[model samples]
Target: MVAQLMRSELPVLIEHFHLPTLPIDPDDVAFILCADNGKATHLVSYDNHLLELDDRYQFRICRTVEFLQDPRVSQAR
Candidate 1:
């Protein structure tokens, strides 16, 4: 599946946005920024800080399993 995705046209390269002053962990900022700048619908992770920020950002923050179980994700598949 990974190889197939790599060969497919679903992957995109996006530029990193400037850091924001978030209350969560500093190291997790890049993930949030990437999702925001890329206009992603979800940001999947297992980090407690990121999960705690579920409703704060434009994108939905969730665990990997939750993301996989999402109806939208299933529909995409």
Candidate 2:
């Protein structure tokens, strides 16, 4: 799946992006790094480690339902 995705134009092939320094877990940082590198307007996740953040980044982070119900989320979609 990863090989196929990398071959497509999914924009998952981030090269020189720098990861953000968050107090959360290291693995969670990867999620943030990807979103940041992709210049995403939002960061949606189920992990408490990512959701419980102090809302530090310019991007917004929320759970599944929170993201779904948010009218603002439509802009992202």
Worst 10 residues of 1 by lDDT: 12-21
How many clashes would you count in candidate 2? 0
Best by TM-score: 1
lDDT of 1 by residue, 13-64 (tens): 4345453436357678778888988989999888898888888877889988
lDDT tens digits by residue: candidate 2, 1-77: 98998788686633443544473576676788777778876788878888777377767788777778878777767
TM-score against native, each model: 0.68, 0.61
Candidate 1 similarity to native, TM-score: 0.68
Which sections of candidate 1 miss by over 4 Å? Answer: 1-21
lDDT of each: 0.79, 0.71
